[model samples]
Each structure stands twice: as structure tokens, then as C-alpha cells.
Target: MHVEPVRSGAQKKEFIYLPRQLYRNSPWVPPLWMEEQNGYGRGKNAVLSDNEYELFIARRAGKAVGRILVYIDRAWNDHFQSSDGLFGALDAEDSEDTFNALIQAARLWLEKRGMNRIVGRFTRWRSSGGF
Candidate 1:
């Protein structure tokens, strides 16, 4: 397994595609918003428009198997009085290799930002907020 953080606009789009590719058969998974991604990747997302974020792609045996987005939302921090970092858009194969890659990328992103606490679909608004 290998992890490569995507740093360019074009490469970020590639990272976005990884999830759609993995879950094409999941009917419950709604279609992704490409426009949103373009905006977020290009730093146009209003909420975190000024914050720094990264998209990561994980590969196993030279094949893309997972993806994750790690973001540092400055506004969230200022508003909450905490380092409320976010991990989102996580998708992966069932295998441990795929799971580890996504998490490793997310961990690095948070660790670099001095974020002692983090949130994700596993324990945050990103996955269970919708009603």
C-alpha cells in the first residue's frame, strides 16, 4: 500500500473520483457534487474558502483503492474555540490495506495542523447529520 497526497487542482478531482468509482453500485450513495468539489478544491467553498485543505489518494498494488479529504477549518476553530479539524469524503475498499491508507492520510493532515481532536463521518456531522 502507498499513500500520495494530491496537491493540484486536477489531481484533486482525481481523488474525488475514487469514491464514486468504489461505490458505483451503492444505490444509497447519492451522486457527488462535482461543482462543489471544483469550488472546494480551488478554494471557493464559502465556509472554509480561506482554510487550507488536502485531498489524498491511497493505492494498493498500484491500484487506487481509497480516498479521503482532510481539512483545517479556521472558522470552525475560531467559532468553537478548539481545533475542530474535519475528515470527510472518505471511501475505501473493505480490505485493511484500503482502510489503513485513508486513515493514515487523515492522521498526517491532522497531526501537521496541531489538531488534537478530529471529526469525521465516523463520529461527526458529516455522516449522520442528515435526517
Candidate 2:
């Protein structure tokens, strides 16, 4: 699958819909957590603003498969005094190619914004993984 910026209103909806395909068979996960995924997928989080954050969705043959977000919170930078470009909201089927494309997209976005560093996992601390 390839990753690209979410293109239209319908595509945005498709971005919000990707988790359904990924998590439909998942068990032992609570309903509210699922709701948070839907909410953030649509960029409804309070910290989101048009000038700072943008989201992208991944698709294959016109079907949604994965997603990543590109964000630079002014307040976050102001407080931390850092130039790190934060990216998260990554969810996929554990495919290396799919994950790489998503990472490349976010990297390009951050590079365009003049950010050399990346901090993620959507938490106060970074998570260690293949990324």
C-alpha cells in the first residue's frame, strides 16, 4: 500500500474508517478506546488546528489501509523549546512496506516544515520498536 495526504472530504471519512478494517476482529479492547481512535482519525482532538496539524491516510487500489499524522504544535514547541516534529496515529497491519510509506510521508512533511527531529507514539515518552 502507498501513503499519501488525505485528498477530499470523502477521503477524510475513509481515513476515519480505516481502523474498522484493522480492528474489526480485535477482542478485549474497550469500546471507549475505539471511540478515541475514531475521534482522532477525524482530527477532532482539541490540540488540532488547521495551521499546525495535517493528517494523511494510506490506501491500496483506492481502499483505505493505514494512516499517519503530521503535526507541529506551537505550544508544545514553546514549552519544550524544541524543533521536533511530532507524528503518530500510525496504525496498519504490521506490514513493513506499508509502515515505511507512512513514515516517509511524515518525514517529508516534517522536512518541509524545517524540523529535523521526530517524536511520537502519541504519548509523553517515545515507544521503542522497529521505527
Q: Where does candidate 1 clash, by residue pair? A: none
Q: What lDDT would candidate 2 get against the real structure?
A: 0.74
Candidate 2, position 80, lDDT? 92
**Stretches of candidate 1 exceeding 4 Å from the true structure:** 8-10, 28-33, 36-39, 122-131
Q: Write the per-residue lDDT of candidate 1 for residues 1-131, one digit (tens) a residue.
A: 88888877667777767767787887756554766466445456564467777778888888788887788888778988987778777778878877777887787778888987778764324555674
- TM-score, candidate number 1: 0.78
Cα lDDT tens digits for candidate 2, 2-119: 6778767777766666676788888725335555555553366666643376778877787677888778877878799988888877877668888888888888898899888878
How far out, in Å, is residue 16 in model 1? Answer: 1.9
**How displaced is residue 101 in candidate 2, in Å?**
0.7
lDDT of each: 0.74, 0.74
